[model samples]
Target: MPLLKVLRPTLPILVGASIMLTLGMGLRQSLGIFLQPLTRDIGISVSDFTLAVAVQNLAWGFLQPMAGALTVRYGFRPVMMIGSVFNVIGLALMAMAHGLTSIIIGGGILIGIALACTASAIAMSVSARAVPATVRSTVLGMVSAAGSLGSLLAAPIGQVLSEDYGWRAGLAGFVVLSILMIPAAWYAGRVDRVPLPKTSGDEIGNTSAGVAVKAAFSNASFLVMTCAYMVCGMQLVFLTTHLPSYLAICGMDPMLSAQTLGVIGGFNVLGSLFFGWAGGRWNKLMLLGMIYVSRSLILAWYFMLPPTPASTLLFGALMGFLWLGVGPLVAGAVAEMFGLRWQAMIQGLAFMSHQLGSFLGAYGGGLIYDALGSYTMAWRIGVALGLAFGIIQIAFALIRPLSPPPVLKAA
Candidate 1:
């Protein structure tokens, strides 16, 4: 069937999913723009601020499985709608923050909880459930590509507002953008009505969540992918949380950081589309390994060179292309490896590892920077670990192809 023909009926659901994802992720990713000003104005150190971000990742990581499980019990609407409200409250708290306590509560805890309900894992699940398997990967890429637009818009807007008005004003702008998520989540919640497809393995969807968890853990391929996902989280979070400070420390123009992030968002569109398409036809895990390897190489290249506008923007483009491409591949792989019924919960298991790495990236980079007055050690460690794991991921994926999805004994 033609792509449009397949999507036309479900257009509203996909669009809502995309918008919810875009705003949720874009705003979160762009939060790094406020780090310097927020910390300075609040009389906190860089590490203190990043500690909140690290906490956010930890909260988001740990809570994701619970949220996914809730979606199974209640529905995506209630989970996502409540998250949208949390997003508003969180951003409002960040805007009015007087101290680290407020920042951690609003930005760290609230936003983290919001993300559990609203971001990539849930968004991809919604998209996967709404579309047919034949074009599932391709559609996931499209949704992810749309999601990339958030950072592109959010970064520039927040930066301009912060530069002219103040950091509070920038967060306020984000709050306004976040309000749109409520309705998006509602529309996206419609997926709850879409029945799971009956297939030979339809019984897989009927398994208890506990049974599903056991099955997922027993799969070796799933385990390797989960481990490798940690490295992915580490590298990406380090950049989002630290890249601005790195550029500023180099005496580059302040706007340059936002611009670089925007460039990343723009290029992310192309990368997401390409990877999404590529995933359907190729081995998804191998593609993931390749993205990791490419990202590490790119990180090494950019960090090694002296700062320049052209170099920074080019670096953003390269990195952006590799960025959210992970969304489609990971989500699609999980759905294929398991089944859609528990897809969100299972994927959340892997994301917990990713978020652990994110915690390390955000907080760890700040610690290194505060101690050494440079990102030299941080980037080196990131590059080294990324390469090692990327290679391992590739090798394991090739040697041990994914076994068939687990089958529970007759009850």
Candidate 2:
């Protein structure tokens, strides 16, 4: 009854938001499948191709807050619709690209802007505002799970398209699929019109955008959360951008590599949902700490064990389950601490930190491999950072939430 009550009002918005997230994140995750083909065809080195993806990650971070601010000002509809258009354009350009410049322009700049508009940060912000506080984490987690679903479906489709028809055709197919987000964007924006509950302190209705942003940045919990989120981005991007190639180097079949990624996506659905539910009842910070610790352990075990199909799938499943599990908890914590007044903007700032990590992870993996002629060092670095971030999050659990800032008086 409680779940039904929460779902009644928010279901439509959640579905719409999830669809947008699914398309955006799904396409992004499938990019790893293209690396070898794209590089071989373009006659560029792996490092050069990955640099463009790294630039895309940087551009996404740089533009996220700006996109969030725009969504705050103009509402989610226009921002998401415009972003969907950019997605089509970006994919189309990438399909036609033959050089680094075009790849950077299309994949890095355009698609980066598109992701800022359409990714989980914006979706979670909208969902947080639409749902009752009781079900907020569940809704956020479900949206994250939906994104994993996208990756699950897209991975195989992308692999098939790329292998059979060339990477260009695969990208073009994504362009067609991206058009569906236009209507979802329109429906998702409708939630913005929903009235906010009147609550004391920093409820969505009580605070202005400027005040909320200021308060969020000034809060120690948010800053620590943002730092930990950066590590999440690093791990995620590095794996998504390079995992297939890494598997290839380890003597795995290409099809098996794609299948492994798909398996990761599949398991992530359960992981996100479980973490989302757990976030409601458990210590969110501790849960985040565990997720990072799990990642480090998984990576360590992966390298320690022999590289084989069964072992690879097991690793993929473990990693997938932990992959985006941190997302809902982080978003839920932000909403709990800051309220939903400018949730999109504040969450965007946190996601910007994530994207910054993504830039380094995606680009740095390529750089390390190019110089060292192996990805072993990069994997080692991921293990170290994961352990460090896990400790940082546990330390953060000791800090109390900051008191809300004083409301300014009129002259």
Candidate 3:
């Protein structure tokens, strides 16, 4: 199909969304590098910095549904522009963070909200609309891979900046990068919305954005997808934030830490793309089940692996391959069952669950470490949760998608 005169080609929209996501997540992940440094600078405990990051993660989860709703209502242009502004403000405040309040509100909450707006929910929706279903997964993976690209850069760069410059200066680098997203988002909004495919599931119909969100929350399949995603967030945020520090304290080299992290990012591109393809070719619920089960195994091995470069590389590669595939898988599933007309909002609500998980991951990991004086316990908890989540997801795949809720006429 030809690009709409007013809308850009789907390719550009995907590219734009990818750029925004990469920077947003890349910069956020880099905060782990600064976790100890920033806390020490402000004379606060790790708990304080963790709390701020936790708030940010939770806020992103809570706000995603709202951002998705707005995207459905007004188009992605204005909403993405708003997200860009939030990024600049949040990064600026984070760079100047001198107290807990500054860190929590500016660094944490604002950034989370921005991520909800521009991350997978925004990017995948655009990709789903633009490409044929046959290749949509590949395109979606490509977009997500861009985020890993950012993660690849953020670590070493963040370490260098924080070590040679200061945490504030390092954060300022993200601030400058974030400012460039404004126009890119505007272009993304111009893509024409694609019609949803016909399937055995309920017939997706046109509805006001408000009605769509209301109905999505009430729908059973959407709920299952959302709930499953919540755990994904928790696992991710907790691991990313605390892993390096734990490794370092265990007598590991700093270079190994960075390399392991970078390797994860590199392998994740493969995971994201493979999962995207799997979503289209097979059942989404089953794919999720497999991913989670594999995660449980990976966590088990990761805990057993001694602190060393070889083990670190192997673990990083394994986990990275499993990361971020959830976004495309879940988002594509929602779009598949409910249709695409209200996708932005419905997908956003589901992503909120992810944000909540992220909150737990960051804050809970920090809390566990502080309380135990070791990450051994934290790693054990992760293994249990992964197994439990895998079982729950396997059960979820057995049911058929429920019908969309009865549409109400306007009063």
Top TM-score prediction, candidate number = 1
Can you write out model 1's per-residue Cα lDDT over 293-395, one digit (the tens) per residue? Answer: 9999999999999989999999999999999999999998888878788889999999999999999999999999999989999999999999999999999
TM-scores for the candidates:
0.98, 0.95, 0.90
Candidate 3 lDDT over 48-152, as tens digits, reads: 888988988878778877887776667777888888889889989988988888898887888877877777788777767766656665567667777677778
lDDT of 3 at 219: 68
User: What is the lDDT, from 0 to 100, of the residue 232 in candidate 2?
Assistant: 87
Question: Comparing candidate 1 with candidate 2, which one achieves the higher TM-score?
Answer: 1
User: In candidate 1, which residue ranges exceed 4 Å CA deviation?
Assistant: 199-202, 406-411
lDDT, candidate 2, at 230: 86
- Full-model lDDT for every candidate: 0.92, 0.83, 0.75
lDDT of 2 by residue, 219-255 (tens): 7777877888888888889989998898888888888
| Candidate number with the higher lDDT (1 or 3) | 1
